[model samples]
Target: MNLNLRHAIMQNISGNSQEELRETIVDAIQNGEEKMLPGLGVLFEVIWQNCSEQDRQEMVQVLESSVRK
Candidate 1:
């Protein structure tokens, strides 16, 4: 059986409202379960794919700065 996690995650969240999306992220973070990491990565992939180059750079910088803490 083929388990396509990224596609499945996208399907689960498709058509969600902005607030609903925010809640999903917030809930996932608060829970801090390892199983939730793939879904979060897929969401971040979608964001990276849609954003401009400058936005991508900014996100990278933000990630770098946060991880240094």
Candidate 2:
């Protein structure tokens, strides 16, 4: 059997508002469960695909800063 994770994740969150999306992300991080990682990755993929180049650069900078800590 095959699973389409990205499509499934998007469908699950299709109608979420900004507040709900934030809550979901915060909760996932706070919970620190490995299962949530792929979903976060998919979300980040969506953000990366949609965001501007400057925003992508900023995000990479933030990640670099976080990793150095």
Candidate 3:
């Protein structure tokens, strides 16, 4: 079966408020399921696209720090 996963995930959460989105992210991370990774990636992609360069750099720094532990 063909699936546009990103599109489907985005569509599913399109109307979510900020709090709802935060809860979704928290739940996904807490669950730690492989299936949730793609959804988190899409969320990160949206955040990356919308953020400023400085914000992106900060995120990169955080990512780097996270992986070093």
Candidate 4:
């Protein structure tokens, strides 16, 4: 079976509202399932593509801090 996971996930959530997106993220994280990681990575790719340099820097900082604790 061939599947383009990123494209499929994007298509599934294409027109979601902010609250719906938030809920999806929260649910994925709370579920803590390995299968959810790819979806989150695709979401992060979208965010990284759209964010400013400062925003990226802040995200890196937060990621670093989260890993350190």
lDDT of each: 0.92, 0.93, 0.93, 0.93
Q: What are the RMSDs of all candidates, in order?
A: 2.2, 2.0, 2.1, 2.2
lDDT of 3 by residue, 1-69 (tens): 125988899999999999999999999999999989999999999999999999999999999999999
For model 2, residues 1-69, the per-residue Cα lDDT tens digits are 125988899999999999999999999999999999999989999999999999999999999999999
User: So what's the TM-score on candidate 4?
Assistant: 0.93
Candidate 1, position 63, lDDT: 92
lDDT of 1 by residue, 35-54 (tens): 89888888998999999999
What local lDDT does model 4 show for residue 41? 90
Off by over 4 Å in 2: 1-3
Worst ten in a row by lDDT for model 1: 1-10
* Candidate 3, run of 10 with poorest lDDT: 1-10
Between prediction 1 and prediction 3, which has the larger lDDT?
A: 3
lDDT of 4 by residue, 3-60 (tens): 5988899998999999999999999999999999989999999999999999999999
Model 2 CA RMSD to the hidden true structure, in angstroms: 2.0
